[model samples]
Target: MTSTDTATREETPSAHVGPRFRPDIEGMRAIAIGLVVVYHAGVSRLPGGFVGVDVFFVISGFLITGLLVREVTTTGRVSLARFYARRAKRLLPATGLVLIVTVLLTWLTVSAVRWREFGVDVVSAATYVVNWRLAARSVDYLAEDVGASPVQHFWSLAVEEQFYIVWPLLLVAIAWLLRRRPGLRPRRVMAVGIAAVIVPSFAYSVYLTSANPATAFFVTPTRLWELGIGAFVAIGATLWTRVPRVAAIVLGWAGFVAVVGSGFLLTTEVAWPGYAALVPTLGTAAMIVAGYTSGRAGVAGLLSWRPAVWVGGISYSLYLWHWPLIVAATAYWGELSGWWGLVVMAVAVVPSWLSLKLIENPIRFAPALSRSNRLALSVGGNFTAVGVVAGLVLVLLVPSTSAPAVTGGASGSGVSGAGALSGTSAPAGTVDSLAEVEGYVPSVVDAEDDVPPYPEECQVDQVSPDPVVCEWGDTEGDLTVALVGDSKAMQYYSPLDAIAKDEGWRIVSMTKSACGFHDGMQVASGEPYTSCAEWNDAVVENLLDLSPDVLVTSERINDALTDPTDVTTRSVDAMVEAMTRQWTTVTEAGIPMVVIADNPSPGDVSPVYECIADNDGDLAACTFDRERGTADSGAAAQLPAARAVEGVRVVDVRDAICPRSRCVPVIGGVLVYRQTSHITDTYARSMQATLAAALVPQVEAATEDAEGS
Candidate 1:
């Protein structure tokens, strides 16, 4: 019989009435926890160590489903409230402690902007919606640019909690159906359900793994099959027990090998939870089944050892506490500290162990409280902890009035009151206050009414020009205006579409992901520029034929110029000359040409918001220095190349960002930059006025001079 089926003959007075301990399970937990710790500590050998979480999922599914199955086999019904109460007792104490400590650490160390961002995560985590939130944000967990989130790792926990909420109801329904149909076996039904869910979910996971890896990695739906693998094993324990001891031992060894092999073989690039995930998850199931069936004490004895059991016992707390501590430490140190980060992980385990022993175990097994009282305490404590966390986050989010006013400064220097632009000088002639336009510059266009109309025939889905056509504005006017360059150019659609509306120009957007307007430079995706060159050729041919009044383009020549040593190479210089030639083509065609500057290079700041939030409201502490923001040699090269062109007016938003000594990310009252490198949409909108100011005068002057000619 399964351990879960063996109820204690002696009834205890305690509210915590369950199996006293399961050492073999604890040993499995040790393996899973150990993999995670070693992986995060930068053990290069275990690159696929993240699969440890998948192992945990299977283990949880097996154990939890085994308990439900056993309970329903004996009793007529499963108690949903009682099951949830048990989950609360198991999960909340450690989670609540971690959240509180993380908040305290963040308040002391993180900046205001980062704190606010983390607060949103904290709230999402508390509500068990972190998975959806991260997916919505398009966060790539594996990407180096991902910023520190104090609670990002909790996305898994959120998935688990969500499972807990629904799993009991499904289990109860299954039990009820079995009670009605004596002919139908519960085990067979469960087996079919597991197969039905696991097979298709695995297929979908594999498909999504390559298409949108980030979504596939974090979403619970994609990962559900891993848990189902464990559920299948739990229902088939009777068949598993019939296997010989030696065969069981062999299966156990094979399963262990699979887990270790998966950890070493699978990588961030592979499609996960598809076929790849079956190795570790099925292996874990195999080991669990083997341990149960094998009469041989060797494998079971090893798993039941005291040290392994202890680590396994505290695994939940360890998982909960380790990530935030590591993330916070990394944020403070400014990089993943390699070996030094191991020390932080080690330090985190102490508190986690203590909490497991003192707080979690005591509350879980306490006898003084009745079942209803224990339930009340668990529910009340969880909500109260959530409330306290939310309240503290609100206190941090409220902007500080003590912050000094940032005035306009001298050219290329600090903000000075003397150089501040008057309210009348603000573009669009609608903004009335200097303070309103000071750090806040709306981008060139604000509304659909601001730009002109587009023609019906010009409306197209793809960002390429066939007959050099485009939908100009809300009205769909067909006055063709070409949009050219790379993904950087694509990001300008919000501003460019607005401009097109204001000018009554049809936006013939011709863009590629990272392929700039350069002649022969490599594109951003590391591919040769054959497709980019052909696309540019096609665009130039279309634009020449259409004879659009204005040509708008952005220079991503910086993407091709990576090495500082090769800054002046013939190829690099030729790329610059080609960009100048394109400008000449526009000017020669009697078209007003405008070139927008490329944005700053990307950075390694996935948890930037969390870092800022941790630092309280100190902008100086959280913001990356100018050097960190623009470390690329190519960004500087593009600036001079643009300036070299005589008639082309280079629109530089750098002045608005870097008033002096390079650009610090803070602007107005908000954190201007989202990551360490890219300016947030919030900050980007603030610069709209400055961008408009820079472009309007040049465009107006050209228009007036053309009329005179």
Candidate 2:
């Protein structure tokens, strides 16, 4: 969320006029950017350093609104073009510079597999729509595990840009309307307008944050209230008379405590930009108000120190340069922690100082650009030209992204542990074939063509209360397998479809995005996923009405780990309990249930595909410790759950994945997983023979046992 205002205060009309140099406010900018950069760099002491962005939002709102109010008061009419032109001059140059540099660096250094995605992020960053895009991406279940992109920081800039898009026009409308009413001063009318916006936007923010915090954090609507609060302060500041020194000092110290203390007090686990935002939002507003008093007093005095002011001078460029350095450093070390993080921040100073002295100041305050709106228009045009050129360069640069790493070794022959079961548990022989000829980005492929997913109506999201069953794989066949649960449950489609087609069976897909087959609530962003529980009951009813020959269920284990308490214990117990209850319904109805074990997720954060890409053609370099890599096969968590259900049988496929002592990155020359956890369609097709061998018998036995009873 880097902003144009981070280092300079040219946007504020108040700053340009009376009391021009507010060292206190500039120092505040230093504090905000410091928190944001440290938090992003993985400072263990400051988990809540992200609150710095909230502080930025408030400052922006205060400053920008101050400018707008001044324009309305002085001009008696607002020129939208001139206002936007000034904005373009102030914001576009540095932003465009960063985007170009970041894109160039990403293309050169990032894994080829991620270039296509990161390039797209560059486009979004260039246009200032990255925040909304990020918000949408956050809710996408498949995109959940992907690593952070370099331009992820642009989302904050996008939010502020979007705010400016409508705000000036809105103020113009308010000013025009107030002119018709002779008694209303511009300040009074603006305050009324600010209050009106704050009330509903704040309520909506609170509601959205509670309902969808992940999206809420990136969306403009949720953060608008914070900006509105700042605007309120700006308008009130115009009307506020001077206060006593003692009281003002007390307020300043209080603001400092609130702003700095929040870093230690808050955690990201809480739903943000909601009421949790008040601590930082109000504190920043207080700090700004305190700065208005004459002389160095309280927090203002502390902020006025030379070291803080120097950093504050370079704050914008520092914010710009720090993130990409951290990203590059992280990619080099394979991780960033402790001293490494501080090292990255220290190294970023070179670029930050260079950018400040070179790019930002030169263009931002150029004399030629100072006269007419020519500079503003030219900056806008120049940005378009450079942005277009950069986009084209990126496209040409990554012509052939390395395909998802599909290795060609034949299946491994065995597991080595003493207690490791032989025969059934042993790895298949010699994984020697490549399922895919080249490594492609699996997330993109999986999103589009991973498997034949049921339509949106059938593959439900959180909002769908009604379940729609879609059939494939010999839909006319007499034997019906009703596959149900969350996306993890949906992931089996590739193998199951192949199996059903070969065996003359109907495969009915009844799945939701994150809702597992269990009645227990699924958690996301630390909140009980809404609509999932209701959808569950509705799905179970739909399943009963269909009464297929075999009931199939699977769930991504991690999605159900929403509990903040002993997560492993709670998740396992919940899965077991939910499976018992749901399966009881099917078994009582004379239908047999078959549970497919969840696959092992490859890396802790980065997928094996990314690691393989990062490490060059050496796939072995990406091989993880079977203990850590395949650590929690939702399959393991699901073992007792599958066993406790009457008339339910479990089919194991872990042997197919982790055939050796460790979970190999590639099996039979094919990439075992196209996604972080889910197997690729091509790989899943290769495993069709194995899945059929394991699945068919248990399904038949369950059917036979039901009939015999």
Candidate 3:
């Protein structure tokens, strides 16, 4: 077997030395980095900016595979230790510095709750398991309302590191097999390896992309095929080198366009790595092959430019640093808007470039340590970082032992007592006096009209009714009002329950996980989801029969509006019609009907909470306007549909929750929203005065009209 040429070609020393830098590749790196930055910076046009990572994967595969093949051919064995040592020298120094700095910054700027979470992420990132950690956490990279994290970019680095761990060993095995068969060509062996890995991995990727896109995107196994494609090109370099210069230039430029274009067109909504991902991955492969085959002057000239090469030199560092900076900046400022966000991005590149130059390069080229010592040091440092982070995380995982104190007494500030007008009150028979009115009855469905209980198998423990008959608001009362709907309606229990108790009303609740009171949507298993529809029908029928003086209902119907044909729409419309029909039943029975509009929903929940928590009470850290729930047109469109029903009084709390064109998380020392999307039970309870203030008048007016008739 002919030996591999592992030595750096003197003609291109930079290509094979410690840096092993490629200018065109660096230019490509610049392009990739630019796309990601612009996309994350909230540029609306480049919906596909996320595909830049795919480009990076292809580049990494080409370079790492080339290095491994060369080393295996020349040395007769691949050095796992040496390869890892070199990686450590190249990656750890800058990464370690960033981690330490970010931790310190987080402690200073973030709240105690948020700091703990960031610290956990820091530990996960330092240990190189950030990808799995994020996947487990269900971190949605495309969620628009999420707060930025300083270390989220590390997930891709973790993926690359995982790839390096396995690839070298696999190559060593292949090399050993080739050595046994003297007739075997290295390129042929590599081709088989690539094919063996790529086909199944790609197939699995396509499958997982639909079933579990988050996992497919973050995990190494699912992503290996994209890298393998580039590996194929590297192994067959000689064949590509035979192509003509003009052809090479044309192919390279065309590939470049495809890769860049993919970034602008593709979006998070697209099923990735199934078919849409081909555009960028194939484009990158084409460019790599074109550059290798043509060896043309124009292609070389464009790639060899100083600026392109310089950015490429620092590409790894830049990629690592940019995301965290953006996230941190966004978290600190709430929303990065106008030129301010751009300025943050620009300022971020400065430290990133500097770190690459001062830290990353020096560690790799340092002469003080021998290869073995360098390897040991690198491994030891990573291990130490991991241990420290792990210890801190364990401390956080330990649940708190003490219960928090509740502030405000029973019959808390705003709660009213019966038979007496409290504070500056409205007269009897007026809306304000409605608070003083006793014996407020809740509407309920009759025994004959009760819908059957939903199938036991379908109910989720936290979200459904296995623990049937949830009681809130002092838990002792004869008059019960059942609260029902999805998470949005569930969030209102705190305030409603408080008010219920103060007014001597009992609260019974039935809620389902993400199941809007829509009729047509299917359950997780693709079977018809009859629970929501059945529950709503039962609640309405029960209200009519039980004859509670009031029927209070709240639901988030906006999600149904995302797709007009969605089952949510049919279910929600059915629910509204049922409720309207029930309203007639209640009105005829002398009961009032109170329908609360669903709270506005932010695009992402965790990120918003994270941003707010991270900012340590900085108003700018939160992104959504406090006054508005969603900017999505789908949400706005639901209003007219809901309002058209007769005798169903629509109570819009948007004005109470949001006043100044912004719906802030905090109102009068109480947090209006607990998570990004929902208000905290404690905070929601505090808003009882505001809610009662808005609702009492409507209830009293209806009650008065009923008595007059």
The top-ranked prediction according to lDDT is 2
Give the per-residue lDDT digits (tens) of candidate 2, residues 622-686.
Answer: 55555564446566556677777767788877677676565656554455565567766555655
TM-score of 1: 0.73
Instruction: Write model 3 residue lDDT over 314-391, tens digit each, in one string.
Output: 667666666667666765567777366567767778988788668665665676533475554755487447545643
Question: What tens digits encode model 1's per-residue C-alpha lDDT throughout 12-72?
Answer: 1111234334467778788888888878877787888888888888887777777766676
Query: Candidate 2, which segments miss by more than 4 Å at Cα?
Result: 2-11, 15-19, 399-458, 461-468, 474-479, 498-506, 520-535, 558-574, 604-606, 623-631, 653-663, 667-669, 693-697
Give all candidates' CA lDDT scores: 0.60, 0.71, 0.58
* Model 2 TM-score relative to the real fold: 0.87
The reply for model 3, stretches above 4 Å from the true place, is: 1-21, 108-113, 139-146, 179-183, 212-215, 373-485, 488-513, 520-554, 562-673, 677-709
Better of 1 and 2 by TM-score: 2
Candidate 1 Cα errors over 4 Å, as ranges: 1-21, 139-146, 295-298, 368-370, 373-398, 406-478, 484-503, 506-551, 555-557, 560-594, 599-709
Error of 1 at 198 (Å): 1.3
Number of backbone clashes in candidate 1: 42
Best by TM-score: 2
